[model samples]
Target: MRRSGQNRFPEVDALRGCAVVMMLLYHMLFDLVFFGNLKMNLFSPFWRGYVLSGASLFVGLAGLSLTLSFSRERKHRNVVPFSKYLKRGLLLLFYGMVITLVTYLALPESYVRFGVLHCIGTSVILAYPFIPRPWLSLLGGLGSIVAGYFLSLKIFPFSFLLFLGLKPPRFSTLDYFPLFPWFGVVLLGIFAGNFLYPGGERGFTLPNIPAFPFRGLAFLGRHSLTIYLFHQPVILGLLFLLGLIRFPL
Candidate 1:
């Protein structure tokens, strides 16, 4: 039931590309504030909503992409191996650990302990059972979201559980996306993926839109992981070169 000779979905990639643009803009503003050039409040209502929306787009897309991958694999093998997900998840987690190390060295006070990469990696592993069950995924996703709300209300003393949405009092991070709500978002994406792209085929009609306009965005989306890994450094370097920020000698 796959699309004829088309392995990738341009629409999905374009949407992900849009999210990447949003992320870049948000991080640029955040870096400005970090460098003392801006006094804006990112925790304010507008910025908070913006951040949440951008994160949702990324996480949800990851979930949807998982379903497509699973279906595609199923076509080739009788039993999809858990090792496939395991390896992928571990690779992402490894990348996340690298970020953790870099940020800890650079900004120990508010370093990322378990950011979006960690969350996505863990979600990919945990979501294996839920991919084929849309109804269960829906319930699980909503439950996780509700549970996250409750978890955020209380602060625990244990720092080890930070990845699971438990926070110590006064905990701060430049980036953080624990499993509860964010993983729930992934599950919801999985649910939507199953419903919208059952057996890796589009369930709805899409217009024959021109590819030229979307080519750039699609390219960005395809290389999003690399962009995410490098964007901050590039942005900071640009700011430094522009004389907007000076190195502390």
Candidate 2:
């Protein structure tokens, strides 16, 4: 999704593609376990860290991309509108809601109420004010992380606030990413983007190397959202065809 007249950053796209690969691996493992084809503890420390790392890469890149877009837009138009972010956020949220609906019908006991899409969408909208202020973004990001640590220690009774890092005891979900700590990752990415790509131009130098090696990953990154929406179904279908999983009658 390159903006008009904006420089394309293949590195960013490749990194995002790498994260997408990680996500695909994680989901494949999860499906294997869920279908009784594998016996592993996904909640173990190692797996938890794996999940966090992948999510951080995705969310952080989102923030960084937002800053780059904002910088370019500001340069071109002399003013960046909030409506761009609003429309994008709403689109992602709508996609998240569609996932929620599908999951609710497929697995009512554990549907994704607020998954990565929801978090990223909400963060995109929330991070707009801090886009031009790197220092404030750093502070806000760190503060959110600290606050999330404390917030996770207690359980709130209200289910309506689940997206805000508050939840009742035993609240189970297949995928969950609340704002607190996760939003911090996005802010940090914003800070990094502003610092690294000031005025929408690269602030550092790199050797002029060919992009051939990264072509595949960059392609994956460019179409990440579409892949994310369809990968699970494809995986499940393959597993079913191989007799690795069975659909409930």
Candidate 3:
């Protein structure tokens, strides 16, 4: 969360920071595999579950924050505006496109065509109409989960529906999160946000932590997008340099 208004939620920021930390740990293991320093089944059931958990947390947080935004607007004004959500979603989509280009150039074989960024961006746009109706969003989210589970079993002729969880039998990507089950997680977050934090304000009190670790996590959460874009390059570069010391590329 970027501060769009005066109101701030420390709990949300902390939770997001926790997600970021979890993502970094997972990516570090992935980088180790890429660097030939470790050999583990990346696509193993355990790893897949790990990835799903992290992604769910991240996407769910996005939905929660969106609800908070709407609530904040409604508090200040009589209505909530879709323009702000649309603007942010489009910006995220553009960034996702840039990532697609970079990844295709860097690692064409396993490029990200419809990664988490794309899913989140598209989900935000699609979720706008349902923001006002928390119960409906909840039901839709559950339905998506059931639908996506079955959809994943089937294969499409083309990769165009990759964003929608449809793809060819052999299609694969380094990062892929279709708007099926994942979007359902976001919708659940919206429901939780509305239920827990009505009107974008805390429903219960949280004790103050006068500690630096918590503050550092909050900072990381606030600037997650910047970190996500650069962390891979940084990790890869360091690993490559380390590998050169003992083995030839």
Candidate 4:
């Protein structure tokens, strides 16, 4: 399975690419409506609920990829480059911090205290020591999600874990993905990574799934961390400039 030097898993990349594309499209629409460039029927409860599933796809795929990247294979280094992985995870957290600062400066009302990207990056670091054990990661991930569900009630006084999914009495944020259940998802990735190997080498180019979607989506997924931070701001800025130029009403 695992050979030597420059290990490449195009299938996982493609999967991630798919996730990223879906996310980008969703965010594009979300950004458009958010900045008032256009209106969406998200005002309806059903529509709002439907859109929420978009996050699930992003998160679930994130988990899957996280595991895939870190799992051990023959001679290709021990279960995902720990040092590099940790470094990458920290970088993601650093970027998340930058976003938090920007949000505080721009939109304190909807600042991202513990958003998905933040959670994913941080969870990756937190998940490092535990990747070797599959069952433990599974239990941890499941427990985290379940715990998050319970904690959302906001009964406990642990404000810190609020980011862990403990809902503050009237809390609200534009982006939020706490440590508990969210970390569980990453752990799910770890578990899946440990167990599954996409049978036969070569990687990616699944015949059943069409090529265009696969290419665009995989591209998005590969650059997800970068895209996640920048997409909204770019969309919002373009909308603003467009509004100023044409629809100055």
Model 4: residues >4 Å from true position, as ranges?
Answer: 1-6, 37-52, 71-82, 155-158, 198-208, 244-249
- Give candidate 1 misplaced runs (Cα > 4 Å): 1-6, 208-213
TM-scores of all models? 0.95, 0.94, 0.91, 0.79
Candidate 2, TM-score vs. the true structure? 0.94
lDDT of 1 by residue, 160-224 (tens): 99998999989999889999889999999999999898998888988776766577777888889
Candidate 1 displacement at residue 116 in angstroms:
0.5
- Pick by TM-score: 1 or 3, better one: 1
Clashes of 2: 0
RMSD of each: 2.1, 2.4, 2.8, 4.2
Find the candidate with the highest lDDT and give its number. 1
lDDT by residue for model 2 over 1-249, one digit each (tens)?
A: 332223778778888998999999998888888884688999999999998898889999999999998987897796799999999999999999999999999999989999999999899898999999999999999999898889899999788888989988889898888998889999999999999989888888756656665777888888999999999999888888888887667
Q: Give me the overall lDDT of model 4.
A: 0.68
Give candidate 2 misplaced runs (Cα > 4 Å): 1-6, 207-213
Decreasing TM-score order of the candidates:
1, 2, 3, 4
Q: Write the per-residue lDDT of candidate 4 for residues 93-131, one digit (tens) a residue.
A: 888889888988777887888887788788877887766
Ranking by lDDT: 1, 2, 3, 4
Candidate 3 residue lDDT tens string, 1-249 = 233236767667777888899888888778777656587887899988988887888899998988888987897888778888889889889989999999998788889999888888888888997787899989999998888899899988888778888878788688888888889988989988888888777777677666567777777788888888888777777777877212234
Better of 2 and 3 by lDDT: 2
The window of 10 residues in a row where model 4 has the poorest summed lDDT is: 197-206
